[model samples]
Target: MNPTRRQVLGGTAAVVGGSLAGCLGDPGAAGGDSEGEGVFTSFFTLADFTRHVVGDVAEVQNPIPPGEMGHQYEVGSQAQVDAARSAAFVYLDIPGFQNWALDSAENLRSNHEGVTVTDALANVELREIGSGHEHGDDNHEEDHTEEHEEDTHDGGDFDPHYWTDPVRSATSVRTIGEALAEADPDNAETYRSNTDAYVEELETLDETFESELSERSIDTVVVAGHDSYQYLAARYGFEVHSPVGVSPNAEPGSAEISETIDIVDDNGIDVVLYDTFSSPRLAETIVNESNAEEAVAISSAEGTKQQWLDDGWGYVEQMKELNLPAFKAALKAE
Candidate 1:
């Protein structure tokens, strides 16, 4: 639950002291000015987009920080606490790409009663496995976890990887823009303008993906890690084949593992795509068994601190690198 706009303003402005810093710029990792207009506590990838959309109006703070692994992030540190305390509003993906964020949001709320937490997944409609568009059977392989214990092989209740789809990415930008406007009314117009520009860029990215990918002959099977790419699979007509579900931490059963391998064999999938944030252990094993050459890394919703900063990569550039290669490869897959 989020605090109202009035509550954030009228209540305590006791935010943790910090300056605006990015993953690549600072020596200590998290560094910025002690003073700023407002704070946006974002998880990972959305942080970059929020920064772009919010521009100078708000300083974005990532709970998981840059250079850190998003899947392995846990709460209970001074930095996390300070970020929460200072944030006027925080963005959380309820289905959850970040384990710490789920717990941290609650704890942050308890300490900073005025801090507003918005669940980005709340309004978006979700799709079941093989439900969105059928290129073939929904051969999505996922890791075994309590969340997937009753897993109907469905995409599960929470696929926090929604940003894989540019449309959803654009939607998140709008949501952040609205929140920023509410938090800083003086800069509302700026936020709107920023969002409009970013959305146009996303639309163009979507066009690029469709124009390139739609021409491919084999749309049936694409292999990647679990829970990271449903939005992408849905947006295009390709079927996602994964070795694990959304949580990279979850271990798939032997049977589930075998099934995924079989698909890679049958579909002739050549590349094993891993995100920049996660280890390629599972992807490598899958490649070994399926004879799919080797691992190819793509940026998930967010990227490593340095990767985001080094490449001067933002949302659009990241997506282009992620999907374009696959689109070209799919064309080659006979």
Candidate 2:
């Protein structure tokens, strides 16, 4: 006999414990988990997108606690072991962003006979990290130590924050939908239809971003946090200047900070943008030193659990509410 929904979720809670308990809860208790089939994802944004595509077809599980910055997140051994056994396990294939997932993906596939593993970024074109912001001044070439370069993950060759770009995000949705459909063939049609509708919504969001950003007077956005918006910047034809590279944990040197300040001052930027995951101290420093009048928080779609519950926020909703407005203010868009 198959285990009940409560039994499965309770078992998951017992295995993972601590943060996982709070993150998983009862699978069917809320957020469209009525179907009782398990669809586990590595992070919150992917969880939200999977939930949107699967709807009532499967119970989506996002084991990462809300407000937890994904790049810095380390999954417990027991939790990884348990999660590898899930019916469907979805994760980004990007290294360093979710090192645990990348490290264990192959092992999970080998061990979990029933689990379907999906890489949402399988087809998306990832932006190379060092390609952002080339200063033409004397501060252009700062020699990063070999250790720092390794710490920044693969010499910052690829940006993993593809979800920030709606077009890429839609591709992820399609990838996830196909994976889910293949995993549960019985509900394949439903999954595909839902994905189609969700993709349409994302395409509409892409249109909105293009229309709004094209009217902007300013083309440069200075972020006080890590550089996670390369794909978004590339998509919309805006320059993103940041003190650090992709990982929030990668600390910027004083020279990089000075360069960022110079960029903001030279561009007459009025707003400095900070990501939700990183500290605002750097943003404050940049704003104080530059012509930027204020700092705004932009959601990287990596939200806290309480914020999501309180606001009933989803990926698209967050992009529209937090990210879009922040960009508008930062870029001086009409």
State every prediction's TM-score relative to the real structure: 0.74, 0.81
Cα lDDT for residue 169, candidate 2: 90
Q: What is the lDDT of residue 12 in candidate 1?
A: 19
Write candidate 2's Cα lDDT for 1-334 as tens digits.
1111001122111011111111122333323322223667888888889888888755787767777766658768865765664556677655457766655555654554444556676556666567554321122112212133145473244667888899989987887777666545456688889999999999999999998888888899998887778778888999898888777777889999999999998888999999877789999999898888998988778655576668888888889988898999889995
* Tens digits of per-residue lDDT for model 1, 44-127: 676777787777655577666566645545646664565454544454433234545545455555665444454444334444
lDDT (0-100) at residue 331 of candidate 1? 38
Per-model lDDT: 0.57, 0.69
Worst 10 residues of 1 by lDDT: 135-144
Question: Model 2: residues >4 Å from true position, as ranges?
Answer: 1-37, 132-156
- Please report how far candidate 1 places residue 46 from its true position, in Å: 1.9
The parts of candidate 1 lying over 4 Å away from their true place are 1-37, 67-69, 93-116, 128-156, 222-224, 330-334
